[model samples]
Target: MLQQSARDFLNRQAPVKHLRSLRDAGGSKGFSREVWAEMSALGWPAMAIPEEYDGLGFGFTGMGIVLQETGRTLTPCPLLSSAMMAAAAIVHAGDDAQKSTLLPGIASGEALVTLAFDEHTHHRPGQVAATAKRTAGGFCISGHKRFVLDGAMSDQLIVSARTDDRVPDGRGISLFIVPATASGITITPCQVLDTHVLADITLDDVRLPAAALLGAENEGLAILEYALDAGRIGQSAELLGVALEAFERSIAYLKERKQFGVPIGSFQALQHRAAVLFGELELCKSLVLNALHRLDSDANEIAATASMTKAKVVETASKATAEAIQWHGGIGMTDDFDIGFFYKRARILETMLGDRYFHLDRFARQHGY
Candidate 1:
């Protein structure tokens, strides 16, 4: 089903050109509402939600499969930012009433929600300093968040704020559902390496009702961590797809490009490079699939596995994109070539969520090293 979905999208959207057009059109959502409605009609956004919430109940594994396909084409969809990651936040921590009210629209893709967690230059979850002080009717949020995916386009923002005196430990952190059109909100558009649009959001005395809070007060770190773990697995799957696409393109170029009246692939050095890339791709695939399975089965070492998977996928995908460019030689360096597009996207994905350094450190700490 996943592969078919990808094939269907490619057939309809014309692959990389479709994404290029989205960028050219100055898309705020990085996607069209019509396409989003089509995806919703296909029941894709609901794949991660539980069956009780009118979802397919396929869990993270299903989400991983869909993301892999999206990554292959570099589809400008919010499945990762809104559906998989932010929806996980709601599904895992939201109260029954909250779940019933919020998730149905999310599942149907009628509502687009995004996470606003990073408040600083780094991707540290524990560095949340955005204050949510008690007010008359509810609370007032005040601070800034950078690199919020789909922040400007999403209908609802799942914001993380400091709710207590705890600092750098994530204990005082809390998540809230704030309207994107709220009075004190400002969204500044920012572009990343891949030409993907991110929003820098500033909350200046943004007031919300008491019922806007999701999960328990001053105890949101655990919920955030749960959602992050699921996101890491989805990211790994997407990176795996990226690596595979780049590697396949490189192999094709090698077979087609000729030197000395022979295909470049006939050369021993080029053949060796292809073999190494193939091995790494296989290893990445194994790790990604294993992590997805571990999460699906509720494994005890989920944190460690997730970190390991994320770090490996970043390394492998980076290497694959670099090799693809190198093998393509001069043509790959030009803007006309699609390989450059993949390379830029790989570079952006490298530091998204967390970089190699961050995940490696997290892996070490998870193992008590």
Candidate 2:
């Protein structure tokens, strides 16, 4: 029921053409505010948030369902950044007062929050160079963040910085919730290949109250990891949706397009390729489902499962999109075709949160390899 409802809603309100319209218009917002408000009314932003904080408390699996539907339509929204990553961090580490103050806004879609952790071009969460030094009033943060999802339009930013004298060490990390409009903060939009907008943020002597600390200073790595794992699983679910949609569209094209009075799908080679993709997509579905379930149930296994799911899904989605374009031959490569949109989206998702290589390495390390 949840899946159907989400699919129906996204199909009606935010189909692939919605993304094209937003892209063509050169919209700074990157997504539709009206559509996002409707999503809020449907309680999507509150899916994984706790009930006590004016949320649905549905769990990660439920949120994953909604995210998968979004992927199917190539919907441009902050559901992954604000609703999943930033919300998970606050839920896992925020104090009672903080949760009470911040969560309700997120649930209502009145506030947009995103996690800013990456300092380099790669996905090294531990190699933070951002500094947060103690001040008489509270703390002052100074650093730059790149590839911040939804950073340009975010209402709040959950930034990770070094609080102790541990350069590039994970032990001294801390997270702080800072208003995007705060003094000495600059957000610059970066144009990427996909329809989404990423931002480069500069924090120069940005001061905040002591209460802004998300968790214990120098003890926030665990909380960050927990939230990242959840995000990785959520991304995996979205990738699954992308692969499915691309594969489905390619299959339909095969059945419709013909050569010499016969459908291309009747060719043995094309059939074999489709069969392989079908099997791999099926496996990806199981892996993503298991990862989502583990996030809701088994904490100890979440890290490993998240990595495995992310790595596998990334690879499969990459192949699926590539194959989709290949199967479509000439038309798929054209910008006018919707198949190219799936490919572009899949490519961008491949690098977000951690790519295949990053997750594969993490998975091996987690298993003592």
Q: Pick the candidate with the highest TM-score.
A: 2
Off by more than 4 A, model 2: none
Every model's Cα RMSD, please?
1.5, 1.0
The residue ranges of model 1 lying beyond 4 angstroms of the native Cα positions read 166-168, 299-301
lDDT (0 to 1) per candidate: 0.85, 0.92
- TM-score of each prediction: 0.96, 0.98
Give the alpha carbon lDDT tens digit for every residue of 290-356 in model 1. Answer: 9988887884457888899999889989999999999999999987778888878777777778889
**Count of steric clashes across candidates, in order:** 0, 0
